[model samples]
Target: MTIVNQLKISAVSIKGAKALEQNLLEKISKEKYKPHDLFLSLEKISNIYNVNKTTAQRALHSLVGKNYLYQIHGKGTFVAPPAVTFQVLVIADYETGTNNDFGSIFGIPAFLRGVLKKIDLEKYNYSPVMLTKKKFIEILPDIELIYRSCRGVIFFRNIDIFVKTLPVLKDKNIPSFFYGSDALLESVSNADCLVYNEGGITDLAINHLLKLSHKKISYLYIDESPTQKKRFNLFLQENKKYKFCTENDILYFKTIKELIHNNIIPDIKRLLKNGITAIICGQEEAGVYFLNKCLMAGIKIPGELSVLTISNYPICALTPVPLSAVHIPIEEDAGRCLELLIDIIEHGSKSEKHISKTTIVRRLST
Candidate 1:
C-alpha cells in the first residue's frame, strides 16, 4: 500500500483488477488525463467498468503506486506530470493500507493541509517522503542525503528518528520542524518542535466522565511512546482527586493490532464485574473495538460502560456510537511550525519552541 508512484511499481495479481489498472494507466500514460485533470471516482469507475468498488479502488491505487496518478484524499486523483520542483521535504509514516494517505491519520492531514496552505507553491512545492520508522533508520544515510538537499523539513514519527535526524538537520543547517507532544521531546535536544497539548486530553476525560459521576473508570492504551504512557499516568493522577480508578481497572497492549486480535471478553467481563462504569481508550481504534465487543456482550454504551478515546480520527464518526475525543491543535501547530521552518529557510529566522492548543469533542460514546 506504499503509493510512491515515483519510487515503486507493485505487481497486481488479480486479473480483473490488473486489467482495470492497465486500462486506466494506459489512458493516463497517453495523456488522456491532462495535468491536474481529475480521475474518475471509485463509484464512477466501478459503474463504467462493471467492477466492484474494491476492484476500482485497487486499480486506482496501482496507478498511484506506479506514479502514474497522485491523490489528494478528499480531492480526486489526477494524472501526474513531471515531478514538481520540491523545496520542502515532509516526512511521514507510509501507513501500509489501501485508502490511506498522509491524511489517513488523525492529526496529520490537518497539519499537512495547514502547512500546504501557507507554502509558497510557486517557489517551493513539498515533497512528501513516507516511510515507516524502521525503514527510515535502515536507510539513514540515504535519508540524510535527501535532508541535506532540502531547504526545510516537516517531521512526524518515532523519537528514534527525531534523535537521529535532528542533528543532521542542525549540522546541515536545514531547518527542521517536529510534530508531537512535549513528552516526546524530553529525551531529545536542540530540535525546533511543535508540541500539541495532548496532555489536555486528561482534562477532557476527567471533566466528561466525572460530570456523569462515573465510578471505577478504566484507562487502556498501547504504551508505544512516552506520551501514551504519560497520558495514562496523568489520567491516573488526575483521577486520584476523585479516586475513581484502581489497579485492576487498567490494561495495555504493545500494538493496536495485538489489542484487536486478543480476546477482550474476559477483560470486559472482569471490568464490568468489578463495577467499572466507564472506560477511556488512548486510541480511536481501541474505542471502536470496545464498542463492538460491548454490543456483542449485550452491553449498553454509557448505560453499561461509558467509552471515550483520546483521538479524533474519522473512525469516530463511522463507529456505531460516535466516539468522544480530545481534539489537540496539532494541525494548527504544524502549520505554524512549517511557517517557522519556511521563515528559517528563506529569512534565516531563529528556530523556536511552541505548544499547540487542545480541546474536547463529545459524542455519544462519552
Candidate 2:
C-alpha cells in the first residue's frame, strides 16, 4: 500500500483525533522532520492544536504503528523539531586548484536546528556567503556594512578573516561566534565558540581503542592544524598511560597525498604485520578517507584494523563501514552560542566563553 494511503487509512478515527493528526502531519510536512523522530507527546500536541487530551492521545496512537511515532517502555513521547538552518560566513581560498575541502557549514546548521526548537525561526533568514580571503580583506568596509544588517553571523574556514573581522565587531560591540576546529583566536580570546573538545574527545576514542585489545593504533588526520595537532597529542596522552602507545605508536599525516607519498600503505602493512590492529582518526572525513585507503591496500576493517573517527560527520553514516565516532555536541553548542549571543545583544550580559561537552557514539564501524 502507498504510504499516504496507509497513513490516511490509519488516521481515520474520532473527529478530534483526526484533527490532531492533521495538525501534526501538516507541521511535519512543512518542517521536514527526519523519519526517526515522529512521535509526539499527547499533551504537547493537545496544547499546540487546542484539542482535548483524549483526542490527542488517540491521534498519537493512530500514528503509533505507521512509523510516524514509536513508543518506548517508559519514556514520554517526543516529536522531532523541524529541520534547522545555520548560516555560516566563510572566507577561504576556494580556487586553490586542489580537491575541495571536506568540511562544510552544513553540519553545524543541521545540528542547530535539532537543538534550538524553542526558537521561533527554525531556518536562518540570510543566505550563507562564501568569500575569497582576498575579497574578504578588500571588501571589509562593505562587508561590515552588510554584516550590521544580519540577525546573526557564523564564521568558518579562515581564521584570519575571522580574526580581522572580529576586531571590527569587538569595536562595534556586535555579537558574533566562530564554528570550526582551526581558528586563531588569541586576539579574540574571550569570544564564544562551538569547537571540538580536542583533548577530551581524542582521549575517549583512544581509551576505547585501547580497551579493544589494539596495541599499535595509528592516527589519521587531514591538516596539521592546531586542532588536529591537539587531538593527536591527546590521543597519545591518553594511550601513554597504557604503555602500549609511546611516541612511535602515534602517527600524524598532513593529507591523502602526503600519506601516499611517504609510503603510508607500506608502513601500515608493517604495523599490521607487527600486530597493530586499530586506527583512530582525528576527524570524520579523515576517517572515511583513511578507511578507503586501507581498503585499497586490501586491509579489512574491525576484523583486521578497527577504525574510529573523532568528529561525527554525516559521511560516517553512509560509509561502507559506519564509523565509530566521538560526536561533538554541535547542535546543542550552536544553539547555546546563538542563545548567548542573542542574550548579550539584548541584555548586555558580560560572559567570557561557552563550552559544550562531547560524547561517543558506538556504531557499526567501530
How do the residues 1-366 of candidate 2 rate in per-residue lDDT, one tens digit apiece?
999986765555476687777777776666556655635676677777787776777887776645455677688654543333433344445555254344444453454463344254533333345556677667566654755454444554356667778777566555666665523554567666655545667677877877777766776655754565566665566547545444565566666457545656766776677676777777556677777777777888779888888777777777877778888766676566566656665677775655567787877766
lDDT by residue for model 1 over 142-197, one digit each (tens)? Answer: 65465544676677745567777777657766677777777767786667777765
Residue 204 miss distance in model 2 (angstroms): 1.7
- What lDDT, from 0 to 1, does candidate 2 have? 0.63
Question: After superposing candidate 2, which stretches have Cα over 4 Å from the reference?
Answer: 1-99, 105-119, 122-139, 143-148, 182-187, 221-223, 230-241, 260-263
Alpha-carbon lDDT, every model: 0.71, 0.63
Task: After the best TM-score superposition of candidate 2, give how far the Cα of residue 98 lies from its true spot, in angstroms.
Answer: 11
